[model samples]
Target: MCRLLGVVTHAPTRLADTLTDLIEPFTGLSREHCDGWGVAAWQPDGELAVSKDVLPAHASPAFAATLAGSVTDAALLHLRMASPGLPTEPRNTHPFSAGALAFAHNGYFAPVEAIDELIDPDLLAGADGDTDSERYFLRVLTRLHDEDPVDALALAAADIRERAQFASLNCLLLTQDALYAYSEENPDSEVSRRRGPDFFRLRYQARAGRVVVASSGIGAQDGDGWSLLPYRQVLEIRRSDLRVSTHLVRGALVGAGG
Candidate 1:
């Protein structure tokens, strides 16, 4: 598994201090997930700028330099430990983006062929690598960026559940307007999610007018409310309020603000 993090805010903040500098040392939840790390930031006009590599975060000067100067209102990060033959190259890294949305995952899929079938054919150009994480993001982007966002996400999730069995499906999606975190896994038999030790124990930190999402709890402080999000639910977070809606949000209600 890999470590993940994201920052969605109402103001432009320096990621080097919170998400990057904090996770660089060997002292937090993101400490050991240094195999590969990347950041996706939203430009002032809602454009997405992403950078990723297979190198360890603690060692890569490029990533270090990039993070040092990185600042954005919304961003995503992934520190990967490459799965088997997935190849540890820059292209295989995460935070895959389309026009205004950036996506990343922390798990692997079953079959590549089946995963390929779930994605929209025309949006395949966004894919820069063969990793399932990128493919999954591309597929979801195709649906989400379509004329209908809610329908696309539902269709993408259903497509994933039908094909990628016995796998962990933890996804973080950031669009132009808001950010969504869906915590669930579709196993071969039954789908579920666990926290604390094995599965997604990630924390949602809201402080100093900034809200960030990470793969695990870093325990920086107590009063921050750093909540552990629930599984099978979709969290729609904006600048001020964060709301979580129930599962399979109908296409008619997908675009609705949480």
Candidate 2:
């Protein structure tokens, strides 16, 4: 199992306040998930900046301070727990990036041989490791390269549902102009799967004219208006404005001409 953290804002702000100070501490509850942490951000100049380590988040002073000073308009964070037999190399960390997109996941896709045909070869072509999540993200980018982010993501979900038997495919995406997220239906019937939340929620607030989106509710008293995204919902947040619409993602391959 793993954990994810993301922030999409109208302005470039440091990650310290939200991630290191707020989200990283939460990983302690999931014992196996403390393996390592990494974060990827979209550079205003069209490059990606990612910092990853094979060490636990709580013990890494460099990572902790890096989070405190990191600045970006959109970003994704991942806390990993390597599968017992798998090596804990830096390549296996989450928040894998390609071009203007950054991807991270929270579950495993075992017996990967079964879905070997569905995954794109190019995805593995650039992978630093053999983790299934990286393969899945690469496959998704293949379909998304020239399409709308919202549509590509929905289509990718349908493709993923076929072999994963309920992949906890909670992904955070950072595009050139917006931030998107998808929390797929968790297939808990599988023994090696991790649990996911019933709700996939996020919020975007106007701060000094910049928009900020987050997966967690803001404010200690819960006074904020956090938008609740349904299981198959897609959200686009940019410049403080949010556009949300529901799309049936799970059965994308089955109900095609309907």
Candidate 3:
């Protein structure tokens, strides 16, 4: 399990400035989810930057330095809690990057070989980590060859749902153009039961200047302009204007409000 936090601002702004009140609460989650931490940020110019470490966010000076006033139009933060048999190393950290896209996942799937069958051989050959999350990201990237970002994620997620048993497929995908969030999970999974029902639930808030999406642990309260993203759905937040859209995995635009 892990904690995910993504932010998109109408104009480039430091994360500290964009998420003034929520930063502490979000990073504070590292006390428990202390395996490692990673961040991916992008500027309006379409340049993406990523930083991560094997240290817990609360204890890592690198995390503080990266988040302290760095300007960006969009950013995604991940606090990882490694699964039972996974290693806690830099390669296994969240926010894995390939080219211009960065991905962070908050779930785990069983019998890695089962899911490995879905990835492209060449793509799988380039993997530097032994995590199911990175493979999930690569699966989405493989689908990106023909489909759009949202669709690629949807297809990859749908495939995982059908072929492998997983606790949660909830993830944050950050691109040069937009920020994508997908929420899907098996409530009956052991991890879910151990954590609580809301463990896999994702929530987002669209403020006047920015849109913030995060896991349930963030300090967001109900009716505070925060809305829980529906399961089996993906939400897109345009970087240019912060326009938001919600879509079903099967290709229906449920809502475009935000």
Candidate 3: tens digits of C-alpha lDDT, residues 1-258:
899999999888887788888889988999999999999998546678889999999999988888874789899999999999999999999899999999999999876665677778899999989998999998888888878998888778877776678999999999888999999889889888898888899998998998999998876656789998999889999988899999886542232110
Pull out the clashing pairs in model 1: 202-215
Q: Which ten residues in a row have the lowest lDDT in candidate 1?
A: 249-258
Give candidate 2 misplaced runs (Cα > 4 Å): 18-24, 27-32, 44-46, 190-224, 239-258
Residues 61-135, model 2: lDDT tens digits: 767776777777677777787765777888878878877677887666665443456556766556677777776
lDDT measured at residue 48 in model 1 versus the true structure, 0 to 100: 77
Candidate 1 residue lDDT tens string, 1-258: 676777776677666765643554422333456557778887666567888766777767767676667767777777786667877777877777767777878777767556675557776755678787787777777665554444455456556666665355567787777676766554333322443243554557666556777665344333466666654555566734433333455542322221
Off by over 4 Å in 3: 251-258
Clashes within 3 Å, all models in order? 1, 1, 0
Candidate 1: global Cα-lDDT?
0.63
Instruction: Tell me the lDDT of candidate 2.
Output: 0.62
Which prediction has the highest TM-score against the true structure?
A: 3
Worst 10 residues of 2 by lDDT: 214-223
All models: lDDT? 0.63, 0.62, 0.87
For each candidate, what TM-score against the reference? 0.79, 0.78, 0.94
